[model samples]
Target: MKRRKYPKANKMMLVSLGIMTALSLPIQAEEEIFQLDETVVTATRTEQKVKETPASVEVITRKDIETMGAERVVTALKLALNLNLSEASMVGNQVSLRGMNTNQTLILIDGRRMAGEDAGSTANVYELDRVNINNVERIEIVRGPVSSLYGSEALGGVINIIMRKPEKPQSTIGLSTGSKQQNASYHLDLGKQGKWAWTFDTLFTDIQKQRRSETTNMYGPRQFYNISGTYDLAEGKNIDVFYERMSEHLKTTDYTDDGGREYFTNTRNSYGLTYRGRTTRGNYELRTYYNELEKNTDQLEGPGSYSDFDRANYKTWAIDGKNTMRLQDDHVLTFGGEYRTSEYRGTRLEDNGDAVSTVTEHGISKSISEKSVDYQAVYVQDEWKLSDKLLLIPSLRYDDSNRFEDSLSPKLGMTYHFADNFRLKTNFGKGFKAPSISELYMKMTRRPIPTRTVIVIGNPDLKPEKSTSYDISLEGEKGAAFGKLTYFDNDVTDLIGTETTRAGSVSTSKYVNIDKARIKGVELEAGRHLSNNFTVKTAYTFLDAKNAKTGEFLQDRAKNRYSVQLHYDDAQRTGISSILWYEWVRDYRYKDDEDKDTDYNYGTLNFTINKKWNERYSTYFGVDNILDKKIDELVLEGRLWRVGMNYTF
Candidate 1:
């Protein structure tokens, strides 16, 4: 027999943990060097203060959201972080974080995962307005690896949309109308100290149809309605819930009639609930969610008329738990777990006079499919202050599921404060994602040319995708000036995307696992208060992503992006504050375009002004794409403007 050695990631972690404990013997003090003041953070499993954490975090307050006129979460995120928003050739919106697919980026509403759409394998930002901003307190974003805290889909980073709580007993209403569209929202917040508290909000949006460059109808009218509320259970406990629905009606080109009857509709529904509690030792939370979607097209053709329809519905449920403790003088430990399951049902039908004589009959055939996935993970993290200015954070997680092979992920990071206003930080982590149900099982039927073709497949033996990510950030914060710069690199294996095959004259495609890819980028942001009445914010991002297996540039990664904002405020007199802003993005890739260098250079300038008549009311106006320049995308409109008001009593 021969002796063998195995790499001990856990042993290394324990050694670091022990050393941290030994060094903290003499540093225990009752006095807080940093005020443990309450600050909300959903970046971690626990709602901890931002200053006490060992990770880089950014918070977007509700006040800031209103000032920036952020009606959609994506717009709020775009203003907060330098992310790339790309349009899909087929149908949908794709957002990239740190040059990774939008699916790789995880988004949460009040700490629960937001479900993906059926139109494509992507999250729908189109329905963001359904989330009433009047009930949002703030948003937290962690721009780097968070899989050590969150299980999967947090490969690139995490975005948490935290809703507001009713801190007082009050009510408010608002209305607005503007170019091409308008919206109205109302809020009612009632609470009685620690016994019971509740907050309710309602929002409605009716957007006018849009036209193409040729003055022909391109996009149809859209309407949305939402109602949500939260109730406090008891001291250190609470329950929150919400419901949302959106609808779009369009006279589309695909549904044209000689008799002048046209029809097309898209609708979505989403709702969820969350319960939370905090103890002297740690904190705990639980959440559950559901979403549904349906789309239809109906019409009567000229002489040779035909009808078709497509429908899709999605459903999901999830549970997550986390806890944190100050185990020792120098070591803070965090532990948590998560589970999620999703199902999809869809169909496409056409009337060819086989079962129905006329094209006016409902043509949705009986095509039903179902898929489900289960994920369970447990993670533990330790934060050790090695010295007065040196700190180390190491974490490990085990993820097991019925869908793929189990995996163990390890992460290590350090932060060294060398100056009062400067610090150096670095982190490396391993992350993985279970195959999405959509990728594992999808069926399609096609009839082309002379004959018909049918394809049905599910890769039950598929493997989980994995990635290794590393990043370093330099940050500085002073009285009125602050700046941050981060550089990160990601190596992904077993990437999932569509693979196409040809059969006779028909070509069919399905999602499959591929070799590998690499994404690298740098992000910079700076802000300064020049004077008592003047302030400025600016940001820049440079990305270089490629397919390591093919040595080709990755699709849809912009090489350059920049944004600038100037603000002025007067606490006295007019009670008005205004901002002038501009943004520039250099073109990158589109899935439909064969040319790799389809570069585009475009910029936009916009302005917003908010005036408070008194403590009870405020009015504001905003105009986007001020020059009305054409920015082409598959599902997005050209340019638009909005005006609104807020009142409280």
Candidate 2:
């Protein structure tokens, strides 16, 4: 028989907390909430218990994010067992589910799509950095096709970020600093102050990027802000308005032999207005929103000489309305329609050595190109309670767009309770994704020299990508333990990919349909409460992916990934909490330019501690990669430290 002893760090933390508890003000502690019986609103666009949903749904609350000491969406998403995190060429990080690319996974904020320069890449707008962590109430992840209600961009799954709704008056200010980053934020939540409730939040971050031991890509002074308010009109009726904005600038640290450097700037703005009404039989909502994004990048060949640059703008407008009704309390019927319009315009410099510093310096309209599309969609879904232990949901949607033919998507979901604490669920759905502006009508050319030129063009004849997806799961819960196992398969046809044609000193790359692809995977997740103060959780994912036409494996598609976490809380004592987490990844091998296979397996540990001094103050400390794990730019950058403090009044 043997017993493991606690680490010295744990004992030191407990002693420090005890001393603080005696010296600090008196306050009551609140237990952290984590269970499988919670309610979610994104699975079916309606409030339903997670355990009873027709599909697998995962949720990460605000408390979980704080406990992990995560400041970005990409970091927090690591906790989702069904998701795979990988590096993107442009954006630092992106996520995929069931081995599908991020473009197939729709990301929504408050149930609305965001506007950004897609540029035909899986990573869209950099929401990983723009989203204010302090303003997020919870994140809902539904794994499987949901195009029957969400239309395009749901071929793999859906991720919805829900904003906080204030019911009490409180304001908070926070500050944090790390070896490579610094952050500051303010949040104001005003409760029902004479029928007018509102919230305001802002965050500023500066991150110093690195390439091994060298300094570079340091995006600094990133600013973000959000403001919203609600006004009561009558019983069960209200009007809400919201506005958000983000801005940032980045420059490179390495310079070319010719004294050339890279620079870029980005800005985004979004606003919306919504009206909601509820009655004895049903609820209805009508809303409209506008989003705009601007981005520009350039390479400075020398002082005041801007070369190889482009300026782009994208805008989105949407109007939507939906109604949900209850019929005899057995069936919940929901119907919705939407009108959306998107436009993109961009211009690239024609001459690199012409000493042009700005896009408008030469009336760039001659080099500018534009594309736009309008979309109309309507959908209907019915959730039927067949009995106390059986549930059935059927939905259908029709979408029309100027760039693609009309398409119809249908879906079916069912859940059956076979035991007192166990449920079996299955889902089948068809999904659709229309080509983006860049993929459909892009025209750009680059001339590194007078004799050589490279061109990237679009294909107006490209067809829309479609997928047929299915998933089934078995879940159970008893007392303080719960577990879930799920299997998912997706078959996508007419996938859009690039093909290169070279002739002499000229090369052309065009977007085209690249046959079919198949991806399937298994996910296992389980958690248990060891005692009143301790909990443990583990998750694993296994994937099998292939290109149906060539039978080749998908690039960067990992075969095995897993994570483990152990948490402790002194909620009944000094209001302190701590967690130790570790994750490992392997089998995502790929061939390099030299035709050599590259495979590396690595794991790291993260530790964080949080202490609540009282109702109005709190502090936290954390360290990432305690073992000093490093993998160049693909993984961790050795060990990093962070400390934060917040005050509420």
TM-scores of the candidates in the order shown: 0.82, 0.89
Query: Evaluated with lDDT, which candidate comes out highest?
Result: 2
Look at candidate 1 and give me any clashing residue pairs: none
lDDT by residue (tens digit), candidate 1, 111-226: 76655453235454443444556567788877666777776777777777787766788888878777644667778777655655667676665645444332224245555555
Model 2: what TM-score? 0.89
Instruction: Sum up the clashes in candidate 2.
Output: 0
In candidate 1, what residue range of length 10 has the lowest lDDT sum?
349-358
Candidate 1 to native Cα RMSD, angstroms: 10.9
What's the true lDDT of residue 27 in model 2? Answer: 27
Best by TM-score: 2
lDDT of each: 0.65, 0.78
Evaluated at residue 197, the lDDT of candidate 1 is 61
The runs of at least 3 residues in candidate 1 whose Cα sits more than 4 Å from the true structure, single-residue gaps closed, are: 1-40, 48-54, 86-92, 118-121, 125-130, 212-235, 239-275, 287-306, 348-361, 446-458, 571-574, 591-597, 633-639
Write the residue-wise lDDT of candidate 2 on 1-649 in tens digits: 1122324533433443343233223224423345447888887877899878897788998877776666667666767876866654335556576788778788899998888756556344365566777788889998888999999888888989888877689999989888656789999999888889999999998876655323344455788899999999999999999999988887664443246556778899999999999999989999999988897777565666655677778899999999999987789999999999988777632232123233453223326656788999999999999999999999999999998888899999999998997999999999988888788777678765458888878877888899999989988766666677789999999998889899999989888988699988888777666667887777777788888988877866667667677889876434888888886666665555455656556667888888888878888888878999776535457788888888999
